[model samples]
Target: MLHTLPHAEADFRALVRKVTMPKPTTTRRLTTEAGAPIADNQNSATAGVGGPLLLQDQHLLEKLARFNRERIPERVVHARGSGAYGYFEVTDDVTGFTRADFLSAVGRRTDLFIRFSTVADNLGGPDAARDPRGFAVKFYTEEGNYDLVGNNTPVFFIKDPLKFPDFIHSQKRDPFTGKQEPDNVWDFWAHSPEATHQITWLMGDRGIPASYRHMNGYGSHTYQWTNAAGEAFFVKYHFKTNQGIRCLDAAQGAELSGKDPNSHQTDLLQSIERGVYPSWTLYVQIMPAAEAADYRFNPFDLTKVWPHADHPLQRVGRLVLDRNPDNVFAEVEQSAFSPNNFVPGIGPSPDKMLQGRLFAYADAHRYRLGVNHTQLPVNAPKATVADNYGRDGLMASNAYDRHAKNYEPNSYSGPAQSDQPLSAPLALTGHTGTHAAPAHAKDDDFFQAGELYRLMSEDEKNRLVANIAGGLAQVSRDDVVEKNLAHFHAADPEYGKRVEAAVHELRED
Candidate 1:
């Protein structure tokens, strides 16, 4: 400390140099699309100094053109999302219930990609918005890709898909004002009485989830699972978060949205990065196929839930998300999922909404991501090769054999049908027409919702009423407000009375 000798002085000088000097970097030659090395990259080609830019500047032109076409069309719903790579490990032997290869053995694992999204948001919307979260998982199994497209809530607003577009339109911004209108929202809900159960859920304490990791995911539609013996059972999937349920109130959600719009995305990414991976325990409620005919309420109704008392959940597997996407745009944004993407044993049910989605989801992907979207790495099957006769389209990378026959039933053995249907076919008797749902013993729309309201604690009920009134009071039409109140009244008398009083007080103020 007093004085430095010759060696000490040299050591100090070396340390200073090490701290101040730039780290050594390797030379990697930049190239054009054709792999030619670029001589000049700092400036664009010109006729002369400050004269005119040359059109032959391939690099400049290519950059501009690519930049111009950078963005693709956003999704109509669930546009704002975050995705992760994971593995779903079968924890229990479900071979007895389903012949699906992925769930065949207790220790079998299937690679998967999951995307969590806000239901009614744009690309730039805040992650903390009070909206239902889309919890879609694509499992790349040995047989094929099986997509479990679901949502955080166990039930939805409407049972029929015919009303889907109108319901979404009401929830979205008004055409004229470009703002979400309470009048339109409440009006639609008032008219759609079947929406009562889901409305109760949406206005309840769990509406605004604290984070994607803390919420449960449900296959809202009933699906069919066939055993190896060809016995079919109706099934509903539930993925309960291991992290536990956590939610935000109106004040907290608004505050988080303002402070960090991408809070959910950031949280997921950072959690994975820190090696604090999030996981969910998968459970299923199985119903005997024969029981659907007289299950108190329609088992296939998307707007209803199977009571845990009737069909207790059976433990199945666990999904652990351990890796974040390397490139969000290529892996997450461009990813596609479809309810129709089923393997050998798992298949669709007679659920009206589910039946509509089996066609609609795949068609939407074709329109948005092109017919060859399945060839993309994120959507592609990992354990099995796709050997179909599907040919070229935009950006087709020729993932198939070049000399193979293009059509089936040919002299040459192209890909042929498996001969086995995915599930046992239902015996159809009723005529195909625009008809109401088949009646059940307890088909009335309001009783389960009433039960749900009655199950809430005092504080939860208070918050639910306040939250509902905050929106209902802004509705311009008295008839719309009254009709919505009546639906609430049908659910629970005390629930409806409190909400009605709150709305009136707000309107008066």
Candidate 2:
């Protein structure tokens, strides 16, 4: 009784109503990657199809080799993803705010590649899982590759990097049983109450977004922006979807997940092919560096958000993803991004989470891919790159030093690091000490979760309560379920009452 039935029946019906799968068309023209007509694809160019296989056959070798290398190690997170190529167009004049070349001119267009992904799942996991979806974008700007590493939710589960690996482990397979553990999940979540804000969003309708297209994206970190006048401002990015925000109830997600694991992927690719391009309006909330001290909330906290009413969204640009990737493995899987690739105007803030990702992402790529991973076309900058060092590693096809000096600080006319004129040097004052996060007066982890619940429609409310009870009922300990309800109750008394009622009713059944 603790378990609720999967919503396959309801979700499939929705898919049927919204979009129909295109019928496959047969074709006679078969060709290889190199465009040679494949006359005998069913049978490789073996000695005779029955005799000893011939290594002399280059076509056969090519085909097998390509097949062998089809897969790369799936990312530890953000495993399931879909990609598209597009152009990001600046819609307003914000050159006074940041001198980043892509945003310097109102009409400037930068070629962009975006990947939408689900976190905490394997490559083949269902897209409808209750999880965070990554909204990472790679802007191939004239200066360099600019990566906006973001997620659907504006806030994250944790503010500290120390707890990240442990939190991920709880979401992953348990070591002892190699299956998800109810105890493991709650143990981590319960101990760190800061996760409440994000957990609420996850358990609500937003947890399972309708698809990548329906959900909005957020950079979700406080970043620093430098103007041409040598002044710095704290900035946060929000990508508001023009198509309108949408979501699936837990029942709808569970049902759709089992019926079609790749529903989100299909929804995106089909949307573009039909010329119904999904777009997001880019906005930034700018807080002058001088005013950071008096902000009500810890301006740098990843767990909190700046109220839009207080700091109005300033229109900067628009992003339209119009073309799907031609090859999934080559383009989508190999796409790498990192926060450290900032240009002249854009820089990092003191946000701990952003600080961690700035290093962790590039390092992850180095280990997962290689030092030469940037040479891959998907990750390469669109503008010409001039450099002296950073040469020669695995699959190093981008060419090596043509200069006499391979190291920096030499008198040779080799490329030297450029100094940023826009940035006034920051002064450091805090003592080197282990410190707890700055506390806000009304800041409890549960307030936002409660607010999200209060905004749900009557039916959405029922679905949310039911979903929580469904997952909670599976816990063997009644105390664990009670503790979770206590959290909901703290957020909103009615929310806790509803979830508690659902759990009790399910338990008796």
Candidate 3:
């Protein structure tokens, strides 16, 4: 009769049939966090085995206290992400462009870690959602750790940092209903015409990348690269994916979201494990420093891009993700990247968005990963570190300067600032006041958006219109829809008319 029962049910009956409960192994004992042996894990200390629990049970108290505080706060943005270990190899010498030690030689390799993420999602959000992706990289160079914090798109929605918080709030869940409101998103975009170009891209097929490996990466903001001779050049970094670009339309993305929400994360890890390493050829667009002052459009604008016809891409290096992280939490979740972490040759431009990020990124890391976050193995530079500072914080294990004086200019042989000039000084003339960005000679925000719409194929245009109309149809405010349509009409008449008609049809349905 016992044999006739299912295997799992028979096993449970066998256990219950025992004369007494089985004792735990004597060979191994469980310990507390302080490494003290625990006497009885199954029962708490008491006057008797069945009596009321004693108040002096330290083991039980410690276990309960520790269990109550185990989780850290998730990132405010780019919360859903995957990372991998890799090396960036210099394939072509960029000595003429920058004096950085890492890029001096053709075959030199720098250890690196890269993280890919969706912009406006939570930690457990669907990876196939339609949103701009974050492509951030950290290079442990001989000179210090250099972080290229960028997005997949070369251009962003807004030019200034002041609008960033408001823009993000619109994209995130509404405070009232705890759901993403299209009315809020369109209301914000309609008021800010500068967002037209990026909105166009977001509504197009590029919004949903097929996989992280297939999408291109960009150091979206213009940076300054100084050569050995002190000549500065405005440069932009591009990582052209070797796997070729692949995108999913709105329908396909929605289907995958329901079927496999982790499609991107699984694809990247399995690909590297199967020896199909993904690679990207690094390229840079170099512009003479003198030309920036007289450029037709604002060179520092984050909403615009430098046309390829004006300045061509120069091959510099290649980045290959060859290894997966050993521990996802230690390596990927704790990894930090900031624009403030620049090598000697590379520096920031006057772009307002970049300027705000220089401070914001590091500040966020400090809050999220503690003050000594850089000391973590994933973020620490591989080269020699001669840091001198007073520090005692959460997880401050490897203090670089133990016995030495933490103060500068001391009698002790403490490390001093490098005599080499960090960057060339630029002349400043404007007063410190809230003023609008100076307009360039031929600056027009709608021109590029129109050009992009005109460049798309017929099928792409149809899909783009359908995607925009579908999202816009959810918005309840008619005035907001009209304002959004006006911006599109300013960009291209056909683009606006198609979207308007489609949105109206959707409303009728």
Candidate 4:
């Protein structure tokens, strides 16, 4: 038996007291950038308390300098946005179509960040604006980060990327008026016959989504997927909202825009906070590579969608957004996504819009957020290390392997590239020249637009006609309005007639 020491209880009580004591107030002191304690944040050093600020005060100078540069440039497009953290889980076996490790097996889950944005809007623009919603997702997988940059619509305004800047400029505020001019918008549409399909969709009932959760997302561009066997297929992605499609009518959207500008962002945040997670079921329409040549439409056209009947959507996976970002600025605003960020098995198609985006997006991010943007927590790969020769840049926080060589092709064992290519090489036999897309049997600008208009219900047709008329009536130029009306008429005689009548009535009013 051990004998208790004299004053043992006293010593034990002292130890407990030390363990339970509150931390020192000094530990909570405010600090400067270099981590030195700041003596006073409320007061600045001055010449004599009543004089001009002292330049010798390092903290005062640093604070104002940092505050001056607190903001980075916003995105040129898709500026107004919200984001969330989630996971994409493969619910079916899709290994035959693509050897992408993220979708390698059933029940495989990949962490992801999704940003929902409104195209052609400023940061301060209303969320309820009738615009194409951007649905870009960045998946952090073991292979690396994969970004699927897309829009809500299955089609777009123009087929060629060369027209993108002009299309956007027309949609943007006019230089003279500082407002979106109907003449500018309508003139562009009248000239771009390919835009008729997307314009019809845009001015229709679903122009404004009720909330971010209720809208469907589409990988509008066709992509190429190569399997483990090296066989390739063209694919398009669709994310059907489990919450179901819901849209705000023109009146409702207008009211919401005035009353609550942050309605969409707030709705998403609160829904996730209350444990009501939003989910989307992922589907892919796959076409064998050889069939693209003889397809009814130019399969790579960004302004046309493949008819679902020809290639039915196959169930692939589910994406559930379960977490709200703790810090929106750090996680959402600074987040960078690029379509060029492809893992193994997946590659860009011959779609001109997609080919342009492969360069434009990454270049934009590098310009907006420094070259080290990928090293940011939200964008950095979670399951794998980025072992490349990329070196020092702004905000490069990763620990450098100083001993290892920075350049490749070295005996010192620098990071080397994989010997295998990401995807199979495309067959090329054409002379390099400016050319239009190869014509397919049923390829025409107005056919699909007509098909879409004809598929709408009678009520939807009424709304579409009225919406188109409202904007067209504002255009000062009669030629622009008539040219646009002619394209709608080409789609369908009834569609053209209805829009013309509606525009006349609106003009009279």
Clashing pairs in 4: none
Q: Rate the local accuracy (lDDT) of all candidates.
A: 0.91, 0.83, 0.89, 0.92
Clashes of each: 0, 2, 0, 0
lDDT (tens digit, per residue) of candidate 1 on 1-509:
51444456666675587568664485887888789877666678775444499999999998899899888898899999999999999989888888998998888889999999998878999998888999999999989999999999999999888999999999988999998899999999999989989988998988999999999999999999999999999999999999999999999999999999999999999999999999999999999798999899889998889999999999999999999999999899899999999998899898999999998889988988999999998998899998887888888876566678888889887778989998888868868789889888988789889999999999999999999999999999999999999999988898889999999999999
Ordering by lDDT: 4, 1, 3, 2
Q: Tell how far residue 45 is off in model 1, in angstroms.
A: 1.5
lDDT by residue (339-406, candidate 3, tens digit) is: 99989888888889999999998999999999888888999888757375656787786546456776
Local accuracy of candidate 4 as per-residue lDDT tens digits, 1-509: 11275655765685577568775676577789999987666677765425688888899999999999988999989999999999999999999999999999999999999999999878989999899999999999999999999999999999888888899999988989998889999999999999999999999988999999999999999999999999999999999999999998888999999999999999999999999999999999999999999999999999899999999999999999999999988999999999999999999889999999999999899999999999999999998998888888888765987687777788987778788777767767789988898899999999999999999999999889888998999989889989999999999999999999999888888
TM-score of 2: 0.86
The 10-residue segment with the lowest total lDDT in model 2: 41-50
lDDT of 2 by residue, 81-155 (tens): 989999999999987878898899888899999999998888889998899999999998888888999999999
Candidate 1, residue 70: how far the Cα is off, in Å: 1.1
Q: How much does each candidate deviate from the true structure in C-alpha RMSD?
A: 8.5, 12.5, 6.0, 8.9
Question: Where does candidate 3 have its weakest 10-residue lDDT segment?
Answer: 10-19
**Candidate 2, residue 263: how far the Cα is off, in Å:** 1.4
How many times do residue backbones clash in model 4?
A: 0
As for TM-score, the candidate ahead, 2 or 4, is 4
**Superposed model 1: Cα runs more than 4 Å off:** 1-27
